[model samples]
Target chain A: MRPAKTMKIELKVNGKRERREVPPSRTLLELVREDLGLTGTKAYCHSGICGACTVLLDGAAVSSCSLLAAQADGAEVTTIEGLAADGALHPIQQAFIDHFGFQCGYCTPGMVLLTKALLDEVPEPTREDIVRYMGGNICRCTGYAGILASVEAAAKALSTKD
Target chain B: MRPFEYVRPTTVGEATDFLREHGDDALVVAGGTAAVVMMTLGVLRPDYVVDVGFIPELGPELDGSRSGGAGLRLGALTTVRSIERDPAIAGAYGLLADAASQVANVRVRNRATVGGSVCYGEPQTDLPPALIAMGASATIAASTGVRTVPLAGFFEGPYETVLQAGELLTEITVPLPEPGTFGCHAKFTVGSPENKPVANASVLVRTDEAGRCVEARIVMGAVGPVPVVAEAAAALLAGEVPDAKLIAEVAARAADATDPQDDLRGPVWYKRRIAAVLVERALSCALRKAGNGTR
Candidate 1:
């Protein structure tokens, strides 16, 4: 067997620029959770099926578990941990808390990040849009009523702030 | 996932050369949505992963113009989400757009590429039947240069293609439908929004000024080793004004052409039945779009 080769990748995580040398087999989920020690992004199905590993890569939501760490080189990555500003929670984060969008909290981070990406693209997404956009993220605890309500509330909150 | 060496070649030529040298030990990865997942599942164990995700030639942006009867050329790296959002594609090839939009979910669509999906050669996927119905073709690059293969004859079997070692799919060109032609795609999933279709159908119909069917193409997917073209069903509508009885006949003919396998989706008989239903609905939808009343 050949020795594993590593590549040094520079990524803009949250608001900071960080670099790491990782093997090619390392997924973005592993890089974020293990190397960067940012465990906010949860990994359930290592495959792309479950959205529990969703994160924003260059402002678009993608399954980090399916994304190679090397592919994310020089890209801007945003996780659930990045939603807070200074000491206050972002509107979407606060909306999730107020709406009780999570129960076991396993799928919360991915759900929250997916909501952020959706609202970023469509500020006033309709119910159909919410269902379609958030369809990938599976929340086993809160069913999905609270998650849908939280997304709607976040949209309203963001619009009112503008 | 097993450890593998990674190489990011700058150009298509360089990539193809590297792949040729590595032989079957190397696998080219674009979006990594399929490749990485297969790797994690131990389904594929390659010694080297050629990361072509960043090559400018294979990005999500569609290149080339659709001027003077020219067809739309989509780079192989074009993301499914990008295809879903492109107004030009939606306006001209609505079936392709709808098919792309229906693939998995937003996150997967955001990462999965049109070329990757096609090259993955999964018969159950939503795009192949729609693409085959649209008369699309793919340009592949290899050490020996390039070749374009029609989407109709691209697949050899399930999860397999005619793609030789060191060959990489670079672009997919879809010819513009002829005047008075309308197309529609429909898929029937079990329950979840993200579930793959148990059976899918794509229909393209063109009606003459007298409201008679001039041309018809019916393609059925997810029920066979490849996207099955129901030529006999298409023949039923070739020169006739489609009606309820004729449409039912065509649907049955299409279902008869299916050679399905029993899997977690359903039994072979159930899948064939769903295929017939989808074909009928897709044909009716396309006929309506073509300004023909299937009464």
Candidate 2:
């Protein structure tokens, strides 16, 4: 097989504008992990599921594995590392800590980012809305109840703040 | 992932030139949902990958009306999530949205292109069968030029499409159903939150001025090598009311229409049975929606 060709993209990653020359076949998951050195995004299945690699592409949560690094061109990407205030944690991150949302914490980044996206979209989403929107993120830790509670808690916090 | 030469063509013509120069050794990466993941898994390794994701021509173009029989014109690069949120699509072609929204997850939907799904034509894909029900068409372009192929005619066989070596799927045109029409999509995937549907079905129904059944179509996906039309189910609605018994019979015909095989998802028989049940349930839901409208 031949070596994959590379393409360059101008991405605003973690609030810093950087240029990345990525393989045409390189996934967004790889871009965030390898080139940018932002390993907070983890992909368990490396497919669409397992939510281990979920990140906000253009402010919408999506599976990074399914996207080519070249596709992130001219877009804003916010990974787990980008979700804080100065050095402080984002509220969603705090909700996870407060609700004890992690067991092994392997899926925490993906779940936290995915939840952050949902709460961003619907600050007062109902339980069913939460389930449908958050169904893609899988937690093998069997810590779903805690994750759901954390999202709900974050939602409550956001509503009160609003 | 095996190393391969990646080429980013600035325009569709440049992309086509790359394909024409590379042939089977080349592959077009639209949304990169299937190709990117497969390449990463070593399931596929093509030489000279062409990046078409940035081609402005292939994006979601929503005109306020999915009515007037002129539905939304979806570029091949239109992400599944685009369908999920577009009110025109959700309001007019909601079934497509239902299928599109549920594809993989929001993450994959953000990058998975509509044309990519139809062009890939994987038997396990979720779009073809739904398009079959909606009377959608695929606009395929090649060196000789483009032609509009009805969604049913595009799927040649397993993992193949009528798309030529140099041809790229440019658009997916979802023809709006008539006013006072109802449509629904169902799939038997093992991962849905409500119930893991192993079989997927799309049903569309239109009633006449006198409140008689005028037209209907139910398409089944993931059951066979290609999206098969549920002719028996469609025929049953010629002049009959979409009652429970009739809907059940139509759904049964839809199930029997397919010769599904065993795979990781489920057994062949199981898929067939769900196809029917989902078809019935979907049509019933469509009927209810139709009743609620100002028909």
> What's the lDDT for all of these models?
0.89, 0.78
Candidate 1 per-residue lDDT over residues A68-146, each given as its tens digit: 9999999999988898998999999899999999998999999999999999999999999999889888987888999
lDDT of 2 at B287: 79
Query: Positional deviation of A13 in candidate 1, in angstroms?
Result: 0.5
Report the TM-score measured on chain A for model 2: 0.93
lDDT of candidate 2 over A1-162, digit per residue (tens)? 223466767888878998978767677888889888899988677667677888888788877887877778888889999988889888899999999888989889988988888887888899999888877788878548888899999899878877
Model 1 steric clash total: 0
State the TM-score for model 1. Answer: 0.96
Task: Evaluate residue B156 in candidate 1 and report its C-alpha lDDT on the 0 to 100 scale.
Answer: 91
User: Candidate 1, residues B54-136: lDDT per residue as tens digits?
Assistant: 77887567644531268888888899998888878876688888789888888989989988999999998889999999899
Please, what are the lDDT tens digits per residue for candidate 2 over residues B193-285? 423346678788887666567888888777777877888769889877677788888888888889788877788888888788888888887
> Candidate 2 DockQ category?
medium
